[model samples]
Target: MTVSSGSPLAPKVVRGAFVRLDEIGIGVVPQVIAFQYNPETLTRKLKPYEQPADKQGTPQDPAARAAPYDPEEEMDVAIAFDAMDDLAEPDRHPQTVISGVADRISALEMLMYPPATPSLLTSAVGALAGALGIGGGADPVPTTTEVPIVLFVWGPGRIVPVKITTFSVEEQAFNSALYPIRAKVTVGIRVLTADYFTSKLTEKGARLTAAESIAATAYRAAVEQKKVLAAVGVASTVESVLATLPF
Candidate 1:
């Protein structure tokens, strides 16, 4: 999206956002949690997967190739929210006057929780039966709680699904109703790789359920896009390097 500036020569400004999908692949794009103001700084770390030290010397199979795995990637960013700006324009942001930044904060936090399921009442009933010494007539249906897939969008080049590993919120001010008026939030996220859907994810012994399988498919699609992007730069990069050579 392009924003009109006083000078036509001004660069385009597109805000970053965290878009929540209905499920994963083929799911509807339902909700968007946009950044009010982009974070000034982002912290990122990558640790490539390598053979263990003990296994390095023990490898004798010449035909076996190196194992492929995605690097462990971590990202941290601080988001600031204030309700004063919205409160100044009450007509457009009437909800802000009532809840301050509470609504926005809730939206971000909800990404970590699974969507409500219809089995909630059934589960409650089973618990009550157990307490009264009455057995449930039949095996209860299992309920799965899967967090919604989220795409962290920083322009078009970097759009990836990530899992929230850490979250911290600091409320600097609150209104009379105890709603936070000004707050700062810090979130630590890890990118989910495509291998996850194929049972190739190597971090833990964890296995994906049917719901997460959908995300794996979408993750693969994103990985393919990244590959194409990298390939496009190869020729130009090689030419630039050759032109700068001393010989």
Candidate 2:
């Protein structure tokens, strides 16, 4: 169901959003995106951090083994896009007539790439100064880039930083500029937990700026909330088991 679905008299609805935060937890202006409509379904997968005793390198002494860690989690969902509603307001969204969903698509696609760096001319000027002995020969702008953190917000219960693992967009109808007016975008993300950060548990060659403590408190809060929900399941689980066994 959509986030807005409810009795007409119900309280205000909360929409899901993708919030971009800087290296130190500050919100990035204009990077926030709220969903127009919620996806019909959300698929989540969890893999426990288990170590088998039979494994060759596994710890033999229970006392020497490391403490159990949180499970790895992933979510996959489809996001729909349509320009018809925006196209209705010609004065407000006139670009839709020519560019269709290009702008919307660009916003999501940009998350996968590095932010724009110094312009070629700026670098050229820097190099020229270095050659003329006006400055250190090292025109050292960072050769590596650290990305801003992205948090997936679904109501108050879940607000965790995540890494986008997979993204695919299927464009349907197009405009004269070859931009899709109708599209289905599927995204897969891996939730970053307490143990995840730069020089920690990360994919090779992948670096996120969360090491600077961006929204880290929120991530821990979300983890605690999930544990509370799991604890609440005890009573319902007992009832179901007794009912099935005719106890």
Which residue pairs clash within candidate 2?
Answer: none
Candidate 2, position 49, lDDT: 58
Off by over 4 Å in 1: 1-12, 23-29, 53-67, 116-142, 200-214, 221-234, 237-240, 243-247
Off by over 4 Å in 2: 1-10, 23-30, 52-67, 116-143, 198-212, 235-247
TM-score of each: 0.69, 0.70
On residues 1-247, what C-alpha lDDT tens digit does candidate 2 reach at each position? 1254567877667877777653211212325667767788989999765556766776566445454777889999788889988888968988888888878777777667654563364466567667776557455334447555688888889988888899999999987778999998888988887666533436766654443365566688998997899888976697777878944
lDDT scores of the candidates, listed in order: 0.74, 0.71
Error of 2 at 172 (Å): 0.7
Kindly list the per-residue Cα lDDT of model 1 for residues 174-220, writing each as its tens digit.
Answer: 98899999999998999887665566455487676444565676667
How big is the positional error of residue 166 in model 1, measured in Å on the Cα after superposition? Answer: 0.5
Candidate with maximal TM-score: 2
lDDT of candidate 2 vs native? Answer: 0.71
